[model samples]
Target: MSQNYPQLDQATRDELVRAYIAIQQIYEEKGSIPKDSETILKRYQGLLETLGAIHLGLLVASFSIVLNFFIVNYILHLLP
Candidate 1:
């Protein structure tokens, strides 16, 4: 990815490389979120937020379907 940032100064590129190493170390050791991951995630918050909204919608739809099934089977005695 640094190849894509040819215009970046050496110091800036070094910082980014260090950040990637830190991030990789955290992920490898914990198998979960790393400390200060919010800094990275914030960079792509718009895309992440959109994905979160879609996930929430799917969860709610699934719950609604389950609730409807219960209503039909128990409340309305429509299923055996």
Candidate 2:
């Protein structure tokens, strides 16, 4: 029974079963497992997220330098 499969979620049992059958069919047709399963997609997604974070950090640092330069120049201009 499907209830015996622990990995099956409460709602996705049918979908997972269909995908599993498709994977089997693909293996029969091409003799190899598909590498683009869910886990691989998550890993690539996380890598993209980390690269985005690095870019954001660089932008923030560049803006901070420009802001500090303007503040320092304005203060020096007001000195007697």
Candidate 3:
């Protein structure tokens, strides 16, 4: 089955083309450089630390939501 795609305006299409070209240029420049082992390790470590913090924050938020849900439900049940 053929699926219909949403039509984009001329301005939007032009912007997307510009973004694609910019990204292609960036990829070319990035591929030209091979960083030292230490530098690459440091960059990866920084990325890992950032992702870890994000995951920790999400875990805390989820735990708080679950705890609050139980507490709220317990309180509501006690009112009867």
| Residues 1-80, model 2: lDDT tens digits | 46588776767887777898998888867857654465665768978899999999999999999999999999999998
RMSD of each predicted structure? 12.1, 7.2, 12.2
Report lDDT (CA) for all predictions.
0.85, 0.83, 0.79
In model 3, the clashing pairs are none
The deviation in Å at residue 12 for candidate 3 is 69
What's the residue-level lDDT of 55 in candidate 3? 100
Shift of residue 36 alpha carbon in model 3, Å: 5.6
- The estimated TM-scores of all candidates read 0.46, 0.50, 0.49
Deviation in angstroms for 52 in model 1?
A: 0.5
Which of the two candidates, 1 or 3, achieves a greater TM-score against the reference? Answer: 3
Give per-residue CA lDDT, model 1, range 2-69, as digits (tens).
58878899998889899999988888689676556567678889999999999999999999999999
Off by over 4 Å in 2: 1-43
Candidate 2: residue 54 lDDT (0-100): 100
User: What ranges in model 3 sit over 4 Å off?
Assistant: 1-41
For every model in order, what is the number of clashing pairs? 0, 0, 0
Q: Cα deviation of 45 in candidate 2 (Å)?
A: 1.3
